[model samples]
Target: MAKQSTKNKLDTSALRPLLRYAKPHMWLFILSMVFAVITVATTLYAPILVGNAVDLIIAKGLVDFDGIINIIIKLSVTVTVTGIAQWLMSLCTNKITYCVVRDIRNDAFAKLQKLPLSYIDSHPHGDIISRIISDLEQVSDGLLMGFSQLFTGVCTIFGTLGFMLSINVKITLIVVILTPLSLFVARFIAKNTFKLFHQQSVARGDMTSLVEEMTGNQKVVTAFGYQEEAEEQFEEVNLKLQKVGLNATFFSSLTNPCTRFVNNLVYMAVGIVGALSVIKGVGFTVGNLSCFLTYANQYTKPFNEISGVITELQSAFASAKRVFEVIDETEEIPDSSNATVLTSVDGTLDVDNVSFSYVPDVKLIENFNLHVKSGQRTAIVGPTGCGKTTMINLLMRFYDTDSGEIRISGEPIKDCTRDSMRSMYGMVLQETWLKTGTIRENLCYGKPDASEEEMIAAAKSAHCHGFIKRLPKGYDTVISDSYSTISAGQKQLLCIARVMLSLPPMLILDEATSSIDTRTEILVQRAFEKMMQGRTSFIIAHRLSTIKNADTIIVMDSGHIVEQGSHDELMAKNGFYADLYNSQFAVT
Candidate 1:
């Protein structure tokens, strides 16, 4: 079973990974703590100066002008020093926290690149985005606040307690007795609220996912008149989020007041007990009693602040746990240590005795095998869920074969470095992805070092140059997810052009032209023919007509290739391929 964090206890598992990122910044963190200590020391000492001033006024009345001036000057210097120290601590702590957060974000993103697509397919994109962006931000915020306040808060509490004890132990005992009440209140609130905050974080992620899902498919939502339905579904998720958020906030909000009430009781006890001690002539002066009261307030004030911050800390802890879960997922089964870089790829391929399944008990591809000559165009035709794409996945090593080897150019793929092996082929998916950048930048995405002449030639051949030139800024125009400046067909053409520019030794076009018009498909198919010269290509086309002239056609059913031949040969046999081919032209 996958592990889950216990609500109240911080998952040390999560903390260990976070600290791995923080290890390099250890000195900086220690320095921040030192600065915090200095700030707290100077701050606590100022209360002593205040007590001296009060004693000065009480001992000599208004006639003590010189003494009062000296005390004022000392107080001014002390406050100024404390402020400077506090500022320094703030500066160092912020640097340390953000730097640590930066490292964790970088690692989390890098982990995504190395993860298998199966993991991505099973998980929500919005949740992954939340872990990287929103969750990390929450974790960063908690660290920032903690670094700034934790050291100082801790030091002041103990320091003030010590100072109070020296001033009057009897009154200090009253504060000690009452301090547990604040802790208990904080604990009670924390125990109930941590689980709520965790649920709140999950709800927030679900809400982000809802927004992403709706906005990503706004066209479908509008085309089918699903606006009302979409809004209603969204309202359900939003309402759940509101309920979880309200409960979390309400419970956490109680901490401040409850702790403050206990603090007030302690304050009253300090005042009463200290007054009695002074009256009984226990050698506690008015100044000492004044200092003791100040110390008691100082000691307890941190508890209030800490109690308030506990809510944020728990939220951050939950976010950190989520982030670490993604990072800790077993990485794509690593290539062997002896794996060699794939080079001199000739495109000759062999799939030998391969078997696979998405689930252990449900077999998909069973002991399958195939071979293709170098520089040949192979077409794969199959109905949906016939293991067509799964075959491609195995070829690219996005997944491993269950029980056999795939060889490229007489070398086992398992023996080759995955990066070098995968780089040997160019792929175009059914969906097009264009970043928010200028036209030239997107065109140069794969081959950033390609010459302007090569990029322009690729675009012209892919039929994308005309549309790109028509944009308001031409090649320099910036675009985003809305794709306002181009149509879906144009985006696909650009993606094709990107692949053409890379010009790998082999190509895998999985529904590459699905978005284009029939007229445009002709142009793109012609370009594909031109690009296929002297290079091996694998075409997974639903429209069998597109691959009529392919050098070899492999027809698949379930997980096995049922027939193999050219169009005329398959038609002569009148097998499954022929029936499938004929069915496409049949009237309903």
Candidate 2:
């Protein structure tokens, strides 16, 4: 019902946002309009020269040969000038169309970077990508069509109307009186088609998202024998797109034919009226009637073209709305004017009575409190959905606590600049990410200016050196974040190497070793243990055996800390921690 109401409220107001992007290229648009005027002026004037040539050749022997030749020369000049002006007009419009869309794409991508993690978490990744890429492309096509046809169409209509009025006002009035019928037909079709076009745009985005998800994880789909089910899902979304797209195309297609029918009626009426005036000897002549007929066609032709422009504009506006939605979303909270920049972080952290939830009504974490001294290794263990990762999010300031204060190195995190605060910690998550670049580039991502020796040393320490050397190009081999070119374990090892390259004052390993094999995990664990010395570390682990030597072990359940102590002390108590540890290694 809400969507129905939104469709019903479609108006020209949504196009206002696109004007902001086009403003910088306003001069080019104005130049195109100027060229359009020259094109129209020359095009309309050529008919007058033709009418004069017809007047010169009165009757067989009464023809004035020299006058006919002069009119022909003037006609040739007008045609040449019109061609040049039209070409110039097209060139300017092309530049304006491409430049405006380019600016819009840049702004949309920059906005994506600034949005809060909650927004990214809630929305489908494919849909966001569609708005950025596919929707913007639609806007470009619409702008191009509008520029090429709309400006010249409007100018030609008015220019031809003036020429017709000068020839015979009575016949011009007949053309003007019937003009509204064409407009009415175009408007009726365009109004109904806008809703269908908008629906088509949304369906296309959904299809793109589904395809991205299925294809990116085809291995999982195949492993689970979900191919048939995936095909059914694709068919459902594809059918919805097909339905709306067909309806939109069907109605928009009616604009050209229906307007042309009305326009033809107007043309025939002018031809009859002008021919009768010439016959009755009411001051109209054969040449005047001929010129009026041409003017009449020129006048109504724009209605047909303009109607087509209206249809394309409707689709463009729908796409623009989607792209603007991303740009207008609320961004992450900005830093205060006097936000501190901590150059020397001691890695001390304090979570005081913190509470948070992704949704307002359903609480995930409440009154969560923890304190860690500088250089202490803290291991956070919990069952699935126990807010362990949420704690890390809070520490990294990816999402702020709803009702508490989190201080880093004794200063409130809210008062610190986000870049400086985030720079204090090097993070590696269970789900690895590596950009499309060389191995050395991925390792040096956290520290761009690191020496080659430092990069190889980190890779060696992470036990990925063997694989790195075996690759065709060693450190120069290119890789993508898709994890297609390399094994997941290799990707994880590269991520570990990334953190080691930076060696920030603090570290976060959230199931960081889950992808690697046991032998490699043991070797990486040793590297991490060595790296954690004298630096504060937060390890979110599921494998109990991996974090046995952590300085502090925090066991959590349902967003609350149930037990916390050293490994020996927690085992002695035999409480929640003991049961969790024993359950993992329990006998059948």
Candidate 3:
């Protein structure tokens, strides 16, 4: 089947990358293998000692008691040493497995930092998280099983076979011939199960994404009475996951029982053939036949173990492929080696002949141009679907333009290192992000070294100081994005305070005060006036009342700037800007 072929190809491809992670701990791997050899050799030798004790009993009265006593002592010592070797092998394998998993997790997280924001925006946060957490955990389980069982199982198989061959060639031949049947059964089931397990893993990721989406936006779902719809969506994904999971489980479970049946047949044949050889009075004595039968059982035991491991390995390979996908994505374009780092930025911005789109053939911003002198306040106003946020993204170089040049203080941004260029501006967006930390930590995020006096001043200016003092621990109270105690307005004010603390040369405020009450908005707007006095500022406002004092207001429609002027001039023109401004303030 096409699925089986795909499974094989992916297994081979995924293995190389995994081995590269394991190669760093090759010494541990080699030590585990050495212990496995010692464990298997002693275990096989114990059965031969038992056979020798049986042969020592010639008759009840004439038995060699000393010989039997010596064999018992040897057997006891052999079993104890085997247990110690097995314990050491397990310890080494465990170390190697966790070490490799830790390395993989570290690499995956580092790769995410280098990935383009576009890649993150396009994928589900929960799915990416699943690959790094749940999927990697699956890989860890698989690796542990592999190292613990695979090496020991392999050594046991060959060790048992050699012992059997030395005892009697014909009986050994019977086992070798029948052995392929077990392999065939195991391979046939494993081939079909790999694709099913892969599907199950993907389905689980989808379910995780849906759960994250609903939980993160529970307020929206509750406000709109969308609980029923959300439940229906969750049930649909849950059913699909259950179906694929059951199919994969059913197929993999068949591998063990089916192989055991074939192995049981091999055991029965060896028993009958060896019993006949003993009755024929051949050179093969009772002890030799018993030893050969013991070897036959031990030989076939690994087939059962390895088949189970193959089932587990298939799932591991599938999960590993998902983790690798994130690590292998093309990262953001690196800054040129010779890129200059801007210092003492003057805040002059020039955007000339710029064009861009998130998707090809659906242009968003085209041939846009603008120039802002240092210390001037420019306002950009547009309808909801217009490219207001896209313009901000371009200025920050979150996504590169298709064709254009944006220069800051006469230096093209593309030629400036992203860190230096972004450092020149303080930004506050409509969406607020607060990490899980104390209020003081969040306030001082942009300026870690800001003094307590400076942080208090910024918070007071943003009008969030009164609320911060009311919390249980004042500034020391810990909070996160899901901290239910904080209102949306307070979160926005905290973000504004964060930007004020940094005091960068330029500012980008995109609907920055949308959540604040009208009374607080007036106070914050006055504070913003003082902050923007000499800093070049870009303000994107839906409320026309907020940007009335802007020296230049650029009105955009469908990516092109239709009008650019002072507020009074745009009002006099009675054109698109006038219509947009009036539409917001006119009495209903």
For model 1, the stretches where C-alpha displacement exceeds 4 angstroms are: 1-5, 8-10, 59-62, 481-484
TM-score per candidate, chains pooled: 0.95, 0.97, 0.97
Candidate 1 matches the true fold with a TM-score of 0.95
The digit string of per-residue lDDT tens for model 3 on 297-351 reads 8898888888888889889899999999999999999999999998878889999
Those runs of model 3 whose alpha carbons end farther than 4 Å from true positions after fitting are 1-4, 58-65
**Which candidate comes out best when scored by lDDT?**
3
Number of backbone collisions per candidate:
0, 0, 0
lDDT of 2 by residue, 1-588 (tens): 786466555545557777777888999999999999999999999888888878887887999989988888889999999999999999999999999898999999999999999999998999999998998898999899999999999999889988888888899999999988998999889877877778988999999999999999999999999999999999999999999999999999999989999989998998888888888999988888778888888999888988988899899888888888999999999999999998988889999999999889988999999999999999999899999999999999999889999999899999999999999999999999999889989999999999999999999999999999999999999999975568989999999999999999999999999999998888998899899999999999999989899999999898999999999999999899998899999999
lDDT of candidate model 1 versus the reference: 0.86
Against the reference, the lDDT scores of all candidates come to 0.86, 0.91, 0.92
How many steric clashes does model 1 contain? 0
Rank candidates by TM-score, best first.
Answer: 2, 3, 1
- Cα distance off (Å), candidate 2, residue 562: 0.2
User: lDDT by residue for model 1 over 5-118, one digit each (tens)?
Assistant: 455345465567767877898888788778878888888888887787777775434546788789889889988988988888888888888998898888899999989889
- TM-score for predicted model 2 compared with the true structure: 0.97
